[model samples]
Target: MDRTAHGLTSLRNGVKTLPLAPMRDNSEIRTLIDRVLPVVDEWREHLTVSIGRATELTGLKDTQIRYFEELYRQDRDPAASSGVTRSYSLTDLRRLAVFAELLKEGYRPAQAAEIVRSFADAIDYGAAYTVADALRREGDAITDGFLLSRLASQVIFAAQREIGERLPDARIIAMFLVERRIDGVSAEEFVDIARDIATHPQNVLVAVDRAAVIGNESDSSESVWSDDESSIVLFYSRDPWSVPVPDRAQFCYYRPPSTPDATVVFMVESAGYRSIPPELTVKTSARDHLLDWMVRMCLSIFPEFRQATRAHNYRYRSDGYRLAHTRQSLTRLMHRVRDLIFGDDADVSVACLLLPDDLYKPMYLSILAHAGYPEARARQARLMLYGEGEGLSGRAFNAREPFLTLDAEQDLRVFGAQDERCKVALAAPLLSHWDTHPFGVLYLASQRPASPLWSETAFVALVFGNILSELLGRWWLTRLRRKHDNLLHRYVAEYIRWFNGMDMHGPEFNEGLQQIERIWERIAVTSASSGNVRTVVERLSRQYVTLVVLDIDRSRQLHSRGDEPFLLAAQRHVHQAIAQILPDVRGYWFKNDHTLLVLDGYAPEEAIVLIRRIAGRVQMVPVVIEGRTERTTVTISAALKSLSYQELYDLSHHDREVLRSSLMTIIDTIYEQTRGCERTIKVFQHGVWEKV
Candidate 1:
């Protein structure tokens, strides 16, 4: 039997299987049949086309038609027996017909499906068996097939409107159907076609979705070849429109068990669809586009630096290296700016003022040559805050304003020979946001008399100057921090080294400690007013000093093979812990095994308890060593000593060994008495110390 006959038999069997409610009279049944017969007849006339006929009419292969057929059938009856064949309706055929046409017009399968669905939803077929009847009822038909064509036109127009609204540059091009395993066309050929289309300046975008062949190793038996395998839709568009297209297309596909290769139904532009005007698409202006590109380029070169809070009192001394790096960054930026505003042919020179020590005294940064002038001549240019200088740069710096001169030789006096060679000169002060005075002045000069300096040129110069000002400010702040850190480190080093050579019996012992104390006090008053340094210094000076020596118990267990980083990290962890727990504590690394913490202002008993607490906290936390986390256990011994001038003066005459022995005896006795006691703390009072 023919496929249609088989479908009819299935429909009959399906109807017979339906459960019927008990009816009171035959009239009710007749009334129901009268009402439903027209709709059923309509479906038969439009939707009852065999799968073979569907391929012939819609230009979709058999497999492609089956894909859509299965999608609709499954959607309508998800739990129906899987092996049974289902019938396709006119609704499904109409949607497929529209989708095929859209694919030919260069719409992706998914996009075409969306358009077809929207068209189907928008049309009202009330009581009409055919599209022609529907059009007649709406009074839209002018002649034979005219209404159908017009309806197609309306659907296409709506689809175009949707595409145009969402994607401005994309328009219908062309689409058609193909076989997944055609004789001459291979996957590589399809890829090449896509590449060729993409290369076109106007063809900005391209997309292709292929059907997976049934017999292919990649295909699984469990795969439902419904919306997944029918159509391969491709879309292409011009430049900006060529950006990645949105994935909104919805096309159906099905792979029959008997078919080897999946049917690839596609769409491309043809003569039927109306042409879209090129003017309707958005086109960015060249100037705006260029400016955008320039901004992106600038940002890539100089990313904005985010300043983190200062966590440690240490700074790197790399001023020379930092200055060189800053110069390189500024030079590249200057060249970019010059190329942007003044063309390469123009005799442009750019230089920045250094302002080494004070802002008022400006020196040459010497990054770029001064406007086709020798580097030495540029270096010679300098400015004073109040002095009357011959150079235009000096005048600009004094006035704190941009200075522009048409005749450099006549208007300027400093750098006499060099000024005579330049016809145009422009100087703009590099003003910083964070500072009251300008950091430096940016100078630009052109030797060519033909190149006129416009007002816009001056504006560009000012802008470049401001950018340099901000960058310079960051560099200056970094320099100041390093200088401050170096000074602090120097004083601390001097104090520590000075103690090693001191004799307790000498008169200078008391005087030397007092002098170091005074220096620390001056630093606290002058520089570190309220930060970590100030807190540390105040604590050290105000209270009796307690020395707590912490020795890592299992230091020998640390990995010996390239374990430097692990050891350093462990040390940092300990230091950070102590600093967090006791903000006023000052400590130093002694040898490689231990750290000596100087806790100030605490009595002997209080000092011992504080040290015990610090040790406990450190031991409880785990540290990562050799890629493994291990608890840090340490043995601690502490001794408290007073640094009073009178006590030190009396002890100055005592033997050095006796003084050291007395202090050691006190610490050893305390450790012995309270080795593991939690509540009781061993504190060496003056009486206990004297007895020792």
Candidate 2:
């Protein structure tokens, strides 16, 4: 997985180690133009010289062509005035060329129009809705061409969305064009890509429900129940070698009854035979970009925001206060008081007094008068919530040093008042850009008295307030820059997901590249581009040198041994042996109670020795697989030159057949020789020849 491992070893090395294409620039735009001009010239008649010419050739009325042209034109420029004679640029021309190719490939004009339109929307919006809308509008405007176009366009859009959702930026989307080998850029191919991406662990891309992260529960009842009772249930039915099954995250506890109804009851089930279960497809597929953003917000941006919000609500409840009203009033009062005190510009401060007009004087008096007590003050704070008449407001000029007050009672003469009843406060000068000395008093107030002791809560609040101010100041300065970077990363990651048709956020880049190679094995890239020979070769070779080792009669014995531990121990021995030799050999397989492999990496003579060693060593001791491993090799080089999946399959089948024949022939020969030896020994015992 090293980044530098796949660098250029030679100029002629056509296989580029799947670098995610960078976002296109002006030069790439020019390259696209160069690729499309020739197509345009050849399809000139079908395309027409201008919008007017196209209208004439297609026999469409002026209005129809205008509608089509207008659609294309508007998309070209968002700010352009409608109905202006906006010319089609090279990019537009190239897109038209692709549409023309589809038409020639048998799409009707109307269908072609729909398809082109949908594709345009998908490209422009990066979603499938645009195409869906266009089809809906096509209502009864159907044609063979239109149908083909519609199907093609619809498929492309869906696949693109599927891919784009996984990788959200532009470059990854473009890279998909080059990497994915789906048939004719169709939707099914994209779906296949999406499935692969979803299953591939290296893709690291995950989707989560945003509502769930925000504490919103799923509306479905199944979400709260065990999976067996839910829509999908995980179970084991067949051995791993029997089929290529999707992996599961864990084993199932509730095994369904062995009946056909069981499968119908559970929409999905997963299991493993000689290996561990595979990953869950549905879980991975459900994860998308919004969820990714939520995860980043929670884990990356501010981990404690959600927790703090919850904790604050709990604190309010525990204090016998209605948090909703208290919070609402607090917020409203903060803004209002800020405006009243600071006028046009209000600088944020560590602490400020927020009080209703009616209770201001009473609360202030209670703090400094004979009624001053922590219990009484706390009660008055709650009574203030009940709306009452307003209190008097006054302004004084030429005041001395500013002393803090709870509400309206401003008296600093009695030092004993600074007890639990009247929480102590600090008054620091607020200086702004316009002045150097104190412009206004900045107050810090807490519930704990400062005479001789302070409450634990008050001390904590003091520390918290200081941290908040410093943190907020730093946040204000870097918010814009952080937002920009986050946005860029989001788009790029998404674009790559779209390009690969899978999430690639899980592992580092190199691991993903290896995963991509694994998926590429299952698909065929039809693009006649360079650098695909090695990939094709690797895929074909897998089929040519495949080996299949049949258990012969050991299935029951292994089953009797019981549980995964024993089976795994046996499997590990075989797997380790296979793994060590496969690199030196050509092909290998492990499934069911059989070991099937093909060797093309080594010469025939060398392959013989390697295959024999694998066969002989596998049956060594306590883990007995028929007490002897079978070896078979077929020369596929003559028949499988231009290799393919099907051809590889045929080659493997052919080799297995030949191996079966060899086993039968050996068995028959041994039987015949033993029969003759038995007769000779019986005759010798009866003294037919000399007894020496």
Candidate 3:
């Protein structure tokens, strides 16, 4: 998935990799006037012309056209406007021209006007609500940092949000400009895969969900994405092979006539597939600007923002405090957090924190980064979720200094973890920016008791700890920058979602997404905490996502009552319960306390059914608390938020901002409603909470 983000296509069978198009300058304004305007006649209804030009087309004086309009209006037929602009269209002029012809044939002005109204039946008017208008409007309205032609930008925007409205999956479109062949599948087999997905989608570009990352999660190979065609698109080039095209394919070969050796795309009915007219089609008689536009959009998204937002090259694993080890996507400084945190020094009794908020604070430690270590010590240091001032790591973080204890076994401060078996322990603070708050501590304990080399080892650990701190500072900066860049991508998507059916050729059209991204890049060019893309996407869309929170009621109290084992067992049961209920619904677990499930493509009713099923499982499964068997219902909070459009929303801040807000509101409602108890199932719908 390295190249998968921002529509950068993954290399697969018969997939040719070409550098995508860059964002073009204001010269793009000419694209509409020169190419699409003259060619895409459907664009004419959305596009408007001046009155002087209308007069020229109709061969009538301005006064005469006004007189005809007045006569029609007196009979309650006023000329229509383009909505944005009150200007007339070529259709109006053509209608006028036809009316003048009738007048020459001795018909009254009212009769001529009535005759002009049936011009579509009399003349060849183009398709309405074509994909071209969507493309043209999205492209023209969004003119900044956008290079792909109006056609391409809209295509990319439409690829999922609009076009996917008709599609079966959230397929990512990757453009190919060169002829290539599928390595294993023959042309015929390729058709079968597209027609039926009978074989693995390895032959196409599919984007598997993070759930697809399980079991084989450690395998970060691009091949894993082939499991689902729901989000992959292998865009082909024009006339590249003799393979028969699959009906209703997610992708089609496209090459604009402006390219040097651009040959006509043989069978691609890019626009016709959608029942749009030929002139308003993507592979219309005229098309290069569209190629540019698609490339622009697929460019890691203005992919120059890749220049502005340099974190795209790194896979994100840190959002919402997710941990990473060797090969997991983390900060560049700790490109391999496992090396020092869980690396070669594995045998030396090393323990690292889990879920460090901004510095790995507020959590526990694990010494065995891998399995099959000494079972006794492994169990001892398995996990000790403690308070901020409890563990030696927390002590170092709070005091802002390294801690070294030569006699670790008898040190009461060391806690009774198996690591206390060691004679010496060293702990150092993993520093944060400005040293405001230290988040995590890196701790080490010796396997041997009271060795003379312990002092020197402590000093070396202190020195290396500071070095890691400096690297983490850089890592934090990179993260915030990446966060902002990601927000921009969301804003672009949000604005387009709202603008899909709107007129782009109208006056007063503001390129909100483009302008915002441009201003954000310019303004926050250096700040760690920059602009909020969430705030900008607020009014653009009311995204439809169901937020579900499942937690063990009174988890903190249960943990304090020596119910750690109970809570852990409950988590396993909940995980099993979900797998049994709706295995395909991907849910993200947080801090082992609660599970955050953002359900996309699932109805609120189905999600509630799932919650009830999970509640049944937790209530049915007995756990030993205080050596007594008891079953308790878990606390479940669920809400379904609806949007006006279709979007492939995921679990990233990009799509989760609104969900996050609603999640907070959901939690808040539970706090107020369940003041008397800890367990309850609450669903927020139609602005009311339903308790089950």
Provide the clash count, candidate 2. Answer: 37
Ten-residue stretch with the least lDDT total in model 3: 311-320
Off by over 4 Å in 2: 1-58, 61-576, 579-587, 590-593, 596-692
- Native-to-model Cα distance after best TM-score fit, residue 449 in candidate 3, in Å: 2.3
- Residue 27 shift from truth in candidate 3, angstroms: 33
lDDT of candidates 1 onward, in order: 0.42, 0.30, 0.42
Error in Å for residue 678 of model 3: 38
For residues 1-692, what per-residue lDDT tens digits would candidate 1 score against the true structure?
A: 11231121112214332222222233332322233332333344454666666676668887766554443242645665886554556655556665566556565443344334434542223222357644442342123122222222222222333345545544332221122333345445654443333333131112232221112222232121111122122222212222221232212111212232422222222233433322122232332233223223322221111000011111111121144344556656656655565575444544345343344334332222233446565445344444643366666665677788777767644344264476777778777643456666776666665564677888977887787777777666655444433332323333342333233223322333344344334433533355675555455445454545454445546643322244454555576668877886644554343454545445556666666676666667666443233444433333344443223223323355554554444334433443333223234465563211
lDDT comparing candidate 2 with the true structure: 0.30
- Tens digits of per-residue lDDT, candidate 2, 1-692, equal 12233221211124323332222243333333333344343343443255565443334555655544543343545676887554544434545554455445454444444445545643232223356544642332223222322222222223223333433431111010011122333434534544443333121212211221223232332121111110100111111111122333111111112221111000112232222112111122323333223223322211122122211211111101122222334445444443443333233212332222211122221111111124344234211211221111010001213334443123442123334233444432222222222222223343433232134434443444344334323322233323333333334433343333222122222232233233233443322343677775565555422222212124324442221223333544555566666644322122222232333333333444554455455544245322123221111100011123434333333344553344333223322322212111110113232111
lDDT of 1: 0.42
| Displacement of the residue 472 alpha carbon in candidate 2, Å | 26
Which window of 10 residues has the lowest lDDT sum in candidate 1?
Answer: 303-312
Distance from true location, Cα of 432 in model 2, Å: 50
- Find the number of clashing residue pairs for candidate 1: 28
The prediction achieving the highest TM-score against the true structure is 3
By summed lDDT, which 10 consecutive residues of candidate 2 come out lowest?
229-238
